[model samples]
Target chain A: MADEAHGEGGGLSFHPMDQFEVKPLFGGYDVHWYTITNVTLWLALAILAIIGLMVLTTSKRATVPGRGQSIAELMYGFVYKMVEDVTGKDGIKYFPYIMTLFMFILCANFLGLIPMSFTTTSHIAVTAILGFGVFIAVTVLGFVKNGASFLGLFWVSSAPLPLRPVLAIIEIISYFVRPVSHSIRLAGNMMAGHAVLKVFAGFAQVAAIAPVAIIGVMAIYGLEVLVSAIQAYVFTILTCVYLKDALHPHH
Target chain B: MADNTNAAAEVAAGTQAGMPQLNVGTFDNQIFWLLVTLVVIYFVLSRVALPRIAAILAERQGTITNDIAAAEDLKAKAEAAEAAYDKALADARAEAQRIAGETKAAIQADLDVAIEKADAEIAAKAAESEKAIADIRAGAQDAVKEVAKDAAKDIVALMGGKADAKSITAAVTARMKG
Candidate 1:
């Protein structure tokens, strides 16, 4: 349809945002809550990818790990170290939870880089759930662990007494904004990069600059690959940081 | 340009004219699926993969520790063996030295006994020769005294004087003493 749309007048026509449109997989466009949609399909694929990486590859559980097993162990150690370094020994208990998020986002991001594939993480709805889930969980944990003393996270007692109130207000506002920034940062980066890729691909329709556009797409694709991995890392590390704050809210 | 407008219209119809992410219609579906995915992942990771990997790491650590301990045990055994070998060598050297000393002392005793026996035989042989020479000299002196007495009787008889036997004997004895 996009080719026919372009064939009509020999003009370039590509929808950079169309890839983000959520359509039902089973022929109807009405995306009800129970509708099996592209989101569901990609999310399922991400699950399968995780099962392959973390479950199937490690089923043998070799002490002297083979290639696939080593990769799984490397990912495990990497995220484990991140959680430990950010959250300390107390945070090691939550390692599996954090690992699940990191693996999902990482797999989804890399899968999205495929041509014509849907990027699940590029959606605000999805990332918002992840971000808000972490925020709510950490807040609940802090309260459960520290009770009303959890509010001490906002009260900057180390500062001079006169500046305490202002700093508290600022800290409270920033604390509430954590989920917003966390979710938006990932979605925005993914959406912007994919959209830029589509725009460059759209330029390939014109005969004169097609080569340059292709080269630009290649270059950006490389950058997107880097961003895909980095964004997952950033999201997971930020979660650890928030968990650390909840566990130790003094400084 | 006409096709571009049609495509744009189609997109507007599909995504509601602005960003598809802002479209409120699909939020519920995406969120629902996301929650399902997260739950599935959480269960899978927590139940199976994480524990298995942890076990494997712990097992490896145990194995390494056991190996190091075994190595240390073996090293100690080797050192003990070397020490035994050294002790054995020293003992053998000391035994050899003792044997050599005993052999030298036995040979020295035998040599000393043989030298004493040889010196005693030479002294006995010299005493026997000296006794024989003294007996020969006494026999020669008796014979000379008898001959001198005979010569003196013959001279006295030849001079036709009566010779006294006792006086001749006394004169012979005095001459011999002189």
Candidate 2:
């Protein structure tokens, strides 16, 4: 039995990317990707669901709004309030971006928790992609809004001239590292939490003690749910903070 | 069955051969994919969704402003009506007081005239009664005088034709005594 187990494990062991396969389609003119394709599909589905809900609720548009409309309005109001509180009136321009991020991340995280569903966020590559995109966009916005003054964000003339260069270099390095850190923070958390769950589930499968294994699996599952939501929130808030930096570029 | 065991053994040998070659270097691929996902999300939000939200907010703000303007107009009209009502009430009160004053003055004047007329009538009646009493007294006095003359003539005729004054006097004195 131990030999058979070893054989099975060896067969299953492969590079993480091996799970994602690219296949030729349309007579080799197009390629169909696997993991990233799945992620996009899920994201599209979530957007459709949200839009459908909004349309269903808002069709009537009553003065004394009904329950569905009220619920939809409440969600809209909540997102609006959050953006206003964090970014003020100027932040109103970015409401859709922030709200979309929140909703997408929330849906993705929740969907991953369902039985037999793929967690796109469980891959570090996916998280890094999201982080890098935000980084590029924010940098572009900064330059666009502030012009040449955006470069001043690094030196921060409040410091003495002698120390300014050193501070600037450090700030530049930190800025460059933002995407790396942001992506890793989310991906690392999700990967570690899920890996721990997988390991525990493996233990439950093989362990002789039923009660201990059951408790272990239950505790890990509960923690995973909380971690998933928390990771989504952290990712969203960081995005907002980065956007704020771009808009102001001074502080 | 012997061939199946052989196939299983071959698969186990193949797995064993691959076991020591485990390479845990997929971090770059993960990072690359994560960057892709982030880019897509950012694009969708910035390009498509944000403009719609901004338009909705602006529309809502316009609605609120219009509502406030309407409310303000209504309030102004209400205040104008309140002022008109107050003015009407004050004018009515003033007119009532004026009428009351006129009526009271007219009644007082009428009372004064009535009292004056009554006093004049009473004085005239007293004077007329005094004149009537004086006339009656004069008539009585004249009648008494005439009667006295007639009585004197009668006394003289009753006396003798050629009697002397002393005898006539003594006969009168005796008649008076009888």
Candidate 3:
């Protein structure tokens, strides 16, 4: 499709969405549930990256960390603090789980920044699982921990009695919209940034505007890097926030 | 495979695939792999990465705390040593001053005794000299009286009138008394 975009027109052509296509690694068009696709490869790479950063670097576990170990430790502290801050002290129990999500998203987002690399987090299906997983987990945890009182998350007791039901309806809607917004926010950010980069690169094919386009790509690439990290942070923090809501649904 | 037929057809068409993210064909693949990835990552983090990092962090904190405590201990020790040195210096100065004062007093006492002895010896010598002078005067006076008596007798003889010894003596005595 990208070739079609470039080949069809001697004029300017842009197929920014082509980069997001999921193709099989071994060249089969049939994408089964268990297909060894680019998603698998990227996901696997993300896993390897996590191991390299978190496990291998910290093998010695130096009190004074080396470079790689410092990165690993920094990431640990960053996510650990985020969880503790957003979810409170009780949230520490879920540190490893949150750390996993953070490390994966962070690694994946960065990995996607490499030229021609597949961005796993850019997909709705991928991020939805993560976001909905948090939603379901938080919901279940809330119900399990607070029982029917978990519904109190939607009921604003501080509101006037006449407006309480109305507030509940709004709160309930916002509550359900949490997963949608959480998932889409990350995916949309990644997708939009990458697509913009692609569009700029497409513009680079035009000789007169090639310099401008290249410069634009560079600038947008810088922005994409920022977006990547921020999106990961946003996702993780939102997860923590949801977890906080689950843990203490009163307010 | 059969579920993705429509998606496969769209891809076959090659240009109308629209957003690849919306492609239902790849959702299964993506979701499956995503779950797999999340599970793998979760296990790795929980079992290995996170625990190690946490341990490293805790160990670092423990080391820092201990180091701070050790530094505080050293600082306290240094301050105590300085205090001891100051105390020793003050004690030495006081001891030196006491020794100097004692020596001065001893020298002063010896000097006072010597001065008193010298004064007494000078007084004894002065008394002896006075006595010697008084003896010489008494001897001189006796001699003068003898001379007067002799001279008086000679004069009386020269005048051709012999004077008796008892009368001359009486005359001399009266003259001396006058």
Candidate 3 ranges beyond 4 A from true positions: A1-9, B1-16, B110-178
Model 1 sits at a Cα RMSD from the real structure of 8.6
Highest TM-score against the true fold, candidate: 3
What DockQ would you assign to candidate 3? 0.37
True contacts kept of each: 0.75, 0.12, 0.80
Q: Pick the candidate with the highest DockQ.
A: 3
lDDT of 3 by residue, B1-178 (tens): 4325644655663424568888887888899988888899999999988878888889999999999999999999999999999999999999999999999999999988988888888889888988988898788766766777788899999998898878887788778768
The whole-model C-alpha lDDT of candidate 1 against the native structure comes to 0.91
Give the fraction of native contacts in model 3: 0.80
Off by over 4 Å in 1: A1-10, B1-14, B100-178
What tens digits encode model 1's per-residue C-alpha lDDT throughout B16-94? 5567798887898899999999999999999988998888888989999999999999999999999999999999999
| Whole-model lDDT values for every prediction | 0.91, 0.63, 0.88
In candidate 1, list every pair of residues with a backbone clash.
none
DockQ-based class of model 2: incorrect
Stretches off by above 4 angstroms in model 2 are: A1-41, A53-99, A140-152, A160-166, A192-230, A244-251, B1-53, B110-178
Q: What DockQ class does candidate 1 belong to?
A: acceptable
In candidate 3, list every pair of residues with a backbone clash.
Answer: none
Give DockQ per model, in order. 0.33, 0.06, 0.37
Worst 10 residues of 2 chain A by lDDT: A16-25
Residue A175 of model 3, lDDT score? 92
